[model samples]
Target chain A: MSAPGQAPSAGYAAVFVHEDVPTAEVDRLEALHRPLADSVRDLVDATIRTTVEDEEVRAVRAEVDALVARLRARQLDGPAGVRYNAEGRTWSWGNAVVGERNAVAPPLEVVRDPDGLVHADTVLGAAYEGPPGMVHGGVGALLLDHVMGVAASAHQRVTLTGTLTMRYVRSTPLGPVRVEARIEREEGRKVFVVATLGDPDGVTVEADGVFIVPRWAV
Target chain B: MSAPGQAPSAGYAAVFVHEDVPTAEVDRLEALHRPLADSVRDLVDATIRTTVEDEEVRAVRAEVDALVARLRARQLDGPAGVRYNAEGRTWSWGNAVVGERNAVAPPLEVVRDPDGLVHADTVLGAAYEGPPGMVHGGVGALLLDHVMGVAASAHQRVTLTGTLTMRYVRSTPLGPVRVEARIEREEGRKVFVVATLGDPDGVTVEADGVFIVPRWAV
Candidate 1:
């Protein structure tokens, strides 16, 4: 295993180290980042709906900018590039679907079943809404895309989404919902997945995806 | 047409008003919001890559929390429901795909062709990366979903994504790209659309979608 931040000779972007910090420390960091992400999410929802006086909105924007400057005072010069450490653990805390630091992502926690199905439960709050009270259709697909990709990539093999088809069974209300995906079949480099998004009432979206093992991944 | 914030209720969630602010004002607001959203996006990217001391991260978090509180001090009690006035223009500033208020959305400007095609051009940045240096697979799907949905909803009719299938032909690098979608066929409530995402080099993703006009829509 390579040391932290050290890429194997393959290339910085292509190297997938089978290692990372101890699992315990990674867990601690995830916990630490969660609430911050939560607050930012709240900020997103609030910003969308805030009817604050225009002057007040400007005032708040200035303050937020200052906070941004402070945070930017010390930062990595580039993207967070996937990182793994000596413990054979990989983490991409910046991923749009599951990134721990991404407030824009719904608070989704996906679990893979013993039989290879992947499922996650989350609430699509105001920040995720598209039509009035409904979850954005694309957001539903985004969640499904990730979970389905996860299903296709089970067993430590990397796969990229080649094509995905989704069916909106109904408009998903912006609240608690479940997403599940399972590998339907595989043909050489292509893995097929079937997935669904549901409210407590019933399934609202159904998706089928073809995930490809990229040449680099192979 | 109803007043701002008033739904022409066939049940609020199902109604799509063909009205809103004057095009001039809408354009003004979009311009006004763009820089703020751009900054927020930068903040998101920086947050993910920050390697500050733990104490510094915590301190920054505290400052960010204070900013959040200030913004939340006066806010809407609920989600930003879709609203339109009587100007025959519609805007959903909080929409997940094209909402001007949504910092998480790439700044996509979709144009419908005279021949009924829909296309948009946007640049994906570090914040949207999944694989090292490449656009997140889900992000590609997200872009295609919206464009295809638009294609299905052409002619002042409303349609929701019923089924969307996407194929990732190659890794989409983070940078300028174009997306185009057009109706392939229609059957009753079902609208079929085909789409593609591509960089300057060539197509990277192709998608086909099924969009449906709900019973309420007709």
Candidate 2:
């Protein structure tokens, strides 16, 4: 499984490796990968909310690192910079916390159903704790930004997070949680998106963001 | 050296930290701390854009970490939470990126002059880079959020980042830069602040924000 990326897969650049599958074949495998991505997303939430001990953290880190090395054996150049195929499909797999093919990303794979509903389900675990048993505020923002950005981008054009506002109604406990995002408005290069993060206890975090397609972006 | 706090220090905290101090004595040190804070703010921008090498990073990290451990030893329990004394003094050093006592923070000490002009000078180094030589976009937001929040709170009451917006007018090169912010308007708990990040080549980034005082805050 020793594949080569346009960028070499060693030394300083190894940190950015992710599986680069051929575009034409992804459509055939999307059905299978989608479910696995969901499971990985669960692992992320679990890592963030876990009350596991130091010994467990060590165990998990080593296991994760080993997985990272195996994945490194086959990789692409740098991160999955926003790429578009001849068929107009795009994917980013080296995203910090939730890139497909990014082992470090908690198996999150956002799926936009025929109805335009954007939803993600994932588990919380040990690595993401902030206030003991709760998810970190910055981490929440990261996930929200990605999902909300996805809603804004809608696979149409490139966009950057121009602005984001979050209201933490209550402490979000670590466990199975669902996220939903939808477009609210669009003006010029900016698209406004709204999202909600919830556990069993109703909604814990509500977010509104303005994502901008940079002036230079096509 | 560890003499509680003077009136001026509390006043400076009121200025940059934006919280109240229990002792009126904080006012006595405000004059001294404010200027010191301003210079330190310059340090932050310099560190972010520094062309320094690995040895410098290790040296700086060691000194910074040692100082952090020392401050930890002296403090009651972390930075003073946002609070107000009868005289209306407040401090919050737990802030990411700019808190005085936070080791992880780059140098950021804001100065709120009597005219209410918000001026900051800082340095950026390798650690803060996102695009090789440019400061991380998120880090820019963090610093801007901080000084802008102080502008909203105005050392009078509690304020949190409610909404923040940024424009990357150009690629902000790593180096020394200056930031300036001022109140644009206000509505109840919502305060509007605007700022710019600049080098000798004019402003590279501009920002506008809406900072809010939580419903519970007076």
Candidate 3:
């Protein structure tokens, strides 16, 4: 099967999954909707880092909630767990942290290169703030956890985040940023991965994680 | 240092941080009046898994907001991080996953044995449901993560969850339950820990985690 996040978004350049009805097909939507998904992802990081005002927050929340309600009205039973296409491409759009169609999700899409290295770009808006004008440490970990989870999976083994360690080198300003993750090593059921979240100015948060295929799952 | 969870409230036996604040220490008399912090913790879990009515939600929100405003009147500059006393007691009352005084916290208290084994017991009620009367998987993870983080620390090293792997063995029912954790191995900056959450009936969820000391922190 094609890997998750490999397919493209359709008609909308910023929104990933359109309201098209569910189809019997698997990989079809990815080719049509990746670009839009990519844009929304940027919106997420930007929102977290934005110095927007209360009025803006109200406006954004209203818009977001409306969008959420709209999607909810037509959703398939629950969240979109990872889905694989006819060609083996995987898509998980209803995910709270990484779903493309999910506006509530900070539009994160991890891109895997030929060497298996993973890099992603997204925006953090004001909504994700913990310390005023800065991204919450937990939110940073949440984002890192997913990216690192991807690295551990290597599109091979089905792995879960086993442990994550993060060092806040500095408070992350809410705004545009880049995320990079790489595999460190492997031992039995565990995989070690290192990753970072940074702005154009420089790196702000760095993380290392151990992901595992549980003894039972293995 | 002495472990936390030795407070005076009997209702708090299910929680870890049981230190009682002389009601005199608190400026706002009412916030401390409703219930002991430990019982409040149970209230929170119950709230999450509750089947309360809409009117109850409205009433609770109003009361909660008033309490919040009152607490804010006599507040620290921000959310509580982690605190410890000269007596070697540590308390994190504002942690989203597990904070002792936090009414919003699941109100979990994990105890460690001399052999390094860790165990926790909590009552899940109306507020934590995911499916029909079942505890949400994510909540289960949050509780497990903290317990394992404590296990990995074992008082010597501070660790952040680097990865987490969970298997939903079955739907967790809302009620009294137990959690147990133990270290599996340690390598460099990472510690592997395993845990389980279950009701009186049977094991419901199992987890493995990788806790890490950031390269910089270690």
Judged by whole-model lDDT over C-alpha atoms, candidate 1 comes out at: 0.72
Give the TM-score (vs. native) of candidate 3: 0.46
A108 Cα displacement, candidate 3 (Å): 16
For candidate 1, the chain B TM-score comes to: 0.84
Least well predicted 10-residue stretch by lDDT in candidate 3 chain B: B1-10
Candidate ordering by lDDT (highest first): 1, 3, 2
Off by over 4 Å in 2: A1-158, A162-192, A196-206, A210-218, B1-91, B160-162, B187-190, B212-218
Tens digits of per-residue lDDT for model 2, B1-218: 00012223322243233344455555543332333333333332233223334454344434433332332333232223333456545433323334342222454677888998887888765434433345544456556655675677676565555555666666565677777888998887687888887876888768887766656554
For A145-165, candidate 3 gives per-residue lDDT tens digits of 667767777856555554455
Candidate 3: which stretches are off by over 4 Å?
A1-218, B1-65, B215-218
Alpha carbon lDDT at B40, candidate 1: 63
Q: Relative to the unseen true structure, what is the C-alpha lDDT of residue B51 in candidate 1, on a scale of 0 to 100?
A: 67
Candidate 3: residue B123 lDDT (0-100)? 80
- What Cα-based lDDT does every candidate model obtain? 0.72, 0.51, 0.53
